[model samples]
Structure formats: structure tokens, C-alpha cells
Target: MVRDRLSWMRFCGLGIADTVPDANTLWDFREALIKADALDALFNELDRAINQAGFIPRAGQIVDASLIAAPRQRNSD
Candidate 1:
């Protein structure tokens, strides 16, 4: 019999196949992700376009960006 090399942890009847770190470590990771502002990414790109992108990247910028809701569309029609 070949044993699978993956480790499993149970969370509310669901199997999470990974090594278990401490709860405090998990909390720290959660905090880190919470602080990772994804909205800041677009602002950062716009900032670079205005400030650090020199000329080439600015010229190549997309003028139109359409915002689409993800959940309502689900897999997109």
C-alpha cells in the first residue's frame, strides 16, 4: 500500500491538507493579509504612471478600464 505524502488537518469537518502552525501564527498571518490593501495596487500603478514611469509606460497606459462585479457574473457569461 502506497501512503500519500500529504498531511491533513480537520477544520469543522473539512480536511485542510497542510502542516499545522500555531494559532497565534495563523492570527499573525491573517493580520498581515488584512493589511495588504489590494485597492492600493491600482493607486500604486496610477502613481507610477504619474511619477516613476518616465514616458514609455505612460504612453502605453490604458485609458479605459471597466469595473465589473465578480460574484453576480460568477463564471462570466
Candidate 2:
């Protein structure tokens, strides 16, 4: 799923995976966000590219489950 997002980001002209700033250090992470924010316009432009690519944003399937059942399962089990 992450791969899909990264691929989408690339398609939006944000950049290649390796070309993005290294996020090893706090400074790096901050810088990466700055770069991403600076490219926000480019990302928004993805609406056209995505449409051209035949992608329409729809709600994705629920992959993460809620934790409400966890306590009940533990107690019942």
C-alpha cells in the first residue's frame, strides 16, 4: 500500500523514492516536509494526472480494525 502511495507521489512529479530527502535525522524529516509542502501545488496538480491515468479517488477498504473488540475478546477468552 505504501508502494502505491509512493508510486502516486512519483506520478504527481514529487520525485523518485530515492530522490526524496533522507529522513534518518529529525532535521532530514523536517527538510523533507518542507520540500513536500513546497511542492504542494504540484501534488494538487495530480488531480489532472490522476484523471488522465484513469484513477478516481474513492474510499479504500477498511484495513485497520478498531480496538473496541480487543478488550471483549480478552475477557471472554
Candidate 3:
């Protein structure tokens, strides 16, 4: 679905000439963040901003628990 969608780059605020990164690029970036121990801090900052914006309900909001499947990788073997 992502491969078929050209709007992701625009949604990410990238210029039309900029290429959207593929799954491997996203994974490597995530790995780098984890290696630097920055992932938790990033999440905390996002959560803090959301809370400050009153997005969290006082009674607690029910979040969708569905899991999104990742794209399959081809085996070289």
C-alpha cells in the first residue's frame, strides 16, 4: 500500500523532488535511534506534547489495539 501511495512524502513534508524512503531506510534509522538510546526519549517527548495538547481523555481513551503487519522481506538463500 505504501509503495502504491505517492502522498507519503507530502504527508512527511518533503518536497516533490525528494524521494520517499523505503522500508529498509526506515528500519536502519530506527536501529540507529535505538543504538543511541534515543527512542524512549523521542516517545516521551511525543507523549508529553500530546498530553499538553489535552489529547488524552480524563477518563482514559480506548486506543485501537490492532497490529499493523510489516512488509515481507525476500530471503537471499
Candidate 4:
């Protein structure tokens, strides 16, 4: 999804030509953070900051399904 979605790429600060990490790489990184016991701390900090900024989490989700035109894929032999 990160590679296919421009919004995700932008959120990750990646350019169109940048290589996105594979699933295993992401999983390993998360495991390392968990081993260091930092994941919960990170989430707590994020929650605190968002709350301080007046953001509330509600039950439900909103998706923007805007149509976008993309270039055709070309296969090279």
C-alpha cells in the first residue's frame, strides 16, 4: 500500500523512486522496538501530544476515495 499509495509514500517521506522496505524489514524493526520496551512509550507520547492538541479518537473511519489518474505501467524485457 505504501508503494501504491502516494499519501503513504509522502507520509513516509519517500519519493517515487525510493525503495520501500519489505514487510519483514518492518516486522523486524517493530520487534526490535518491542524488545527495547519502547513501543508503548512511543504510543503514550503520541496519545498525549494528540490529546494536548485537541484531537479525539472516535469509533469509525473515514476514507478519501478520490479518483486520480496515473501513468500506465511499462514492462521491460
Model 1 lDDT per residue over 3-68, tens place: 232333332233444445667876786677568864467667878776764654445667778987
lDDT by residue for model 3 (29-70), tens: 999999999999998998898899889835566879999999
By lDDT rank, best first, the candidates go 4, 3, 2, 1
What are the per-model C-alpha RMSD values against the true structure? 16.5, 9.5, 16.3, 14.4
Query: What stretches of model 3 exceed 4 Å from their correct place?
Result: 1-11, 15-17, 57-77
Tens digit of per-residue lDDT, candidate 4, span 1-77: 89899999998999999999999999999999999999999989988988998999664888899999999999899
Q: Which ten residues in a row have the lowest lDDT in candidate 4?
A: 55-64
Full-model lDDT, candidate 2: 0.62
- CA lDDT of each prediction against the hidden true structure: 0.56, 0.62, 0.80, 0.93
lDDT of each residue in 23-61, candidate 2, tens digit only? 366477567868778556666787778789899876566
Instruction: Give the TM-score (vs. native) of candidate 1.
Output: 0.26
Models 1 onward score TM values of: 0.26, 0.32, 0.54, 0.64
Local distance difference test, candidate 3 = 0.80
Best by TM-score: 4
Score residue 26 of candidate 3 by CA lDDT. 90
Residue 4 lDDT in candidate 1? 32
